[model samples]
Target: MADVTPNVSLVATPEAVSFLQNCQLPVQLNAMTGNPAHYDYDAEINTAITNLQGKAKESATLVARLTQDEVRTSPLKHQEASKLAGRLVELAEGTQRLLTSKAKGYMDASSDFMGKTFTPNPQREGYYLRAADWISREAKNGEGNGYKAIREAVTEDPDFAVAIYNTSHRLLGLPKEHAMDFAEKAVKAFAPAALDYIEKSQRLDELAKRYPAFIAQVRSSYFSPFELAKVRTYVEMPS
Candidate 1:
């Protein structure tokens, strides 16, 4: 199990509060229908917004933890570190899409004023519930490998790598040219462990100290091997 920071908080921003307010149902819809199975659209949308905000904030904190010295330097933590980080990234990005996208804005507006109840897209609610459960379970267990969805994404999903790289660069607060050059240096320095050639348990910390971009990448990606491979140039294990 990787290092755990159990007090992670999923804070909802004021903007999120206002945005969710715009999505509230009018008084007429508050009454429960005679049917026992009647679904509450207002409750559903509010819950989705609330859950997404909390999860995204928690993911940011966990991603920050994944970049800590202990986790980054410990060979034992590397694989689990990547799995947790990748899943958080997937979760964060999905939350961002559902919360901030223009399509969501349009949809919410229609739903709020135009009498629409359920979203045509079931995947939003589906992923939210599934991911919320998975995260809750993993938070308690500290066994990071249980989330197979992100593991598969980090390995086979190019988009995952792309998103991590792009987001990481910005998160690092680096200029584009400097960020690129630094990533190249990180690729050379961390390639062995990333390729599973040498554990280089201490070496990861040494290199991270030298290359701050490496820390940013790990903070953003937990040093996902696929993201490492996708960093401008591909790196492979030497046979």
Candidate 2:
């Protein structure tokens, strides 16, 4: 007296079809135990679950590559991984929103790290501020805030050469007599860290020329690495 009817509507893809075929075998085996009439419906649901599992496995592979450190270090690889990571995070978030319980469990089981990366929160504020400061500095539109931010970054990380360079360069635009001492200090602080100290010294020389008195003071004051090298070169030159 069992109603045995296959539901055809549930078969959507090749994976789904394969899933339903395998699922039906189990239901057909246990037909005499319970719910013989709904075996077809159960088979369809299992088919959908199996198809979802296949898709989840594919996405998980991409997510794994994105969070890997070595992949993020290379410019080309990082760009590609970042895009894939963002997409996977978005997919996880959207799924979580539409199907809270099911998607939540799936995400918890499949990719907890992806879930955390996708969630928006204040932990990312520092990264946003750092990016904004860099953009403003490069655009040369918000010099005051940009310089201030760079200075703060230097305070937090003394070895930050880029921040030191920006701070010193911006300080050069201030009143010559007032900013000279700080600019000299910045140059000294940054000299060892810079890739091209000669170029930096040339730039500072141009700024120092605006105030002859400050130039004299810096020449007589304790010589910075660049200044000492310049002085030694002049001393050795044949006059």
Candidate 3:
């Protein structure tokens, strides 16, 4: 008989909270630089921002559902996590689009003259830096307690990776850099955490040899978009 895998959805459980507490999910104003690129920066950034906004809403919507209906509460404790995740996403995304545009280097004077300038709405790199700053304030303010928490395993999602990388750098209080060197380093540090989970995808092995660290990593991501908020917090925080 094919064994059924238990659903590993994101929930606002103590375990999940504990995991998130190990992370830093807030976006800060300094983590992004809206400098214009030779590429179609605005178009790319728009697509990226849209996606992040959706993610924010998705978490918020789920949390709303769980809270509005008490009947839906017992099987899972996703309430606290969902609410916080939604808030965090919203805060980070909002700051990127709204506040970061005003930062210096957000626009390219050369591109502007040529009508090829970046969109102040949400420049790719700029947005990240701004989002990181916003998140930092929230993180430092103990938003981690109220709307501060996480679990979505940081991965290669373009927008998310940018967020994680930016957040990691921001939490460390690094002056944001133009190159992706820092973000890449952040991703590399966490890549091993998701490797085991990827391996499991090839063959679902309930009793596969498990390393303690591997198990911890797998659990954070196995549930994915649904179980990620808690883990995101961990990645954003320092070691």
Candidate 4:
């Protein structure tokens, strides 16, 4: 009889191990199993990754151009940047809808727990609706007028968290470092209300994870690189 050979397990390379750690477990496992039919799957994955990177770069370029244009414009010239920011807001709204649709598509595509667990749910719809309504009201007043409306709203109702948050976001376009102070004030004003919504949504299983990170990101997004540079200039100038 021919001598039987012992089976030796293959070890993952350092690079492969690092990649696996970064990826979701199912994807990592699929790559490791190395079924012949899936052997070249990395090519498709790499292509997708490259495409995503290119898209992100393009978006970043657009945002930078918009910011530069805003900086160069006078207060009287705010119309141009206002229009661009409005367009961006519209794009963000559309992207959110698209994401929801895609999630539904994924739920429909899968079977068993994969499908069941990802089924459509309406837990945070109310919170989103409230936020959207607030944003819409502010948008109706026009871009340059956001700060005024926010101030009026806050004056009428000092406890209005959403209005305070909107004020912070509006100030992001301003050249003065005072915008940072406003942003901090907004965070303080909105934290309680925002946390209440977060807790309620979490209790309802709407926000499954990363709730704190989500809130933090929203708060921080008020200041971009261009805005920070402007703020710094304002700070350095003598009164």
TM-score winner:
1
Candidate 1 lDDT by residue in tens digits, 1-239: 23333222111234322222222322211221111122123353345434534543454455444445453433433445456556644543443343334334434453343222212234454543443343334334322553344333323433332222333444434345644543333333323233221222222223223323322332443433543443434357799
In order of listing, the candidates' clash counts read: 0, 0, 33, 0
Q: For each candidate, what TM-score against the reference?
A: 0.24, 0.18, 0.23, 0.23
Which of the predicted structures, 2 or 3, would earn the higher lDDT when compared with the native?
3
Please give, for residues 60-139, the per-residue lDDT of candidate 2 as tens digits.
Answer: 34433333434332333324434433443344343323333432333343234322322334565555446435634543
Q: In candidate 2, residue 137 scores what lDDT?
A: 53
Clashes in model 4: which pairs? none
Clashing pairs in 1: none
Worst 10-residue lDDT window for candidate 2 reads 1-10
lDDT string, candidate 4, 164-229, tens digits: 333344433442343444334444443334333333333222211222332232222222234334
Q: Where in model 1 is the C-alpha error above 4 Å?
A: 1-46, 56-73, 100-221, 224-239
Candidate 2 ranges beyond 4 A from true positions: 1-53, 60-73, 101-239
Q: Find the 10 residues in a row with the least total lDDT in model 1.
A: 28-37
Score residue 81 of candidate 4 by CA lDDT. Answer: 29
Order candidates by TM-score, high to low. Answer: 1, 4, 3, 2
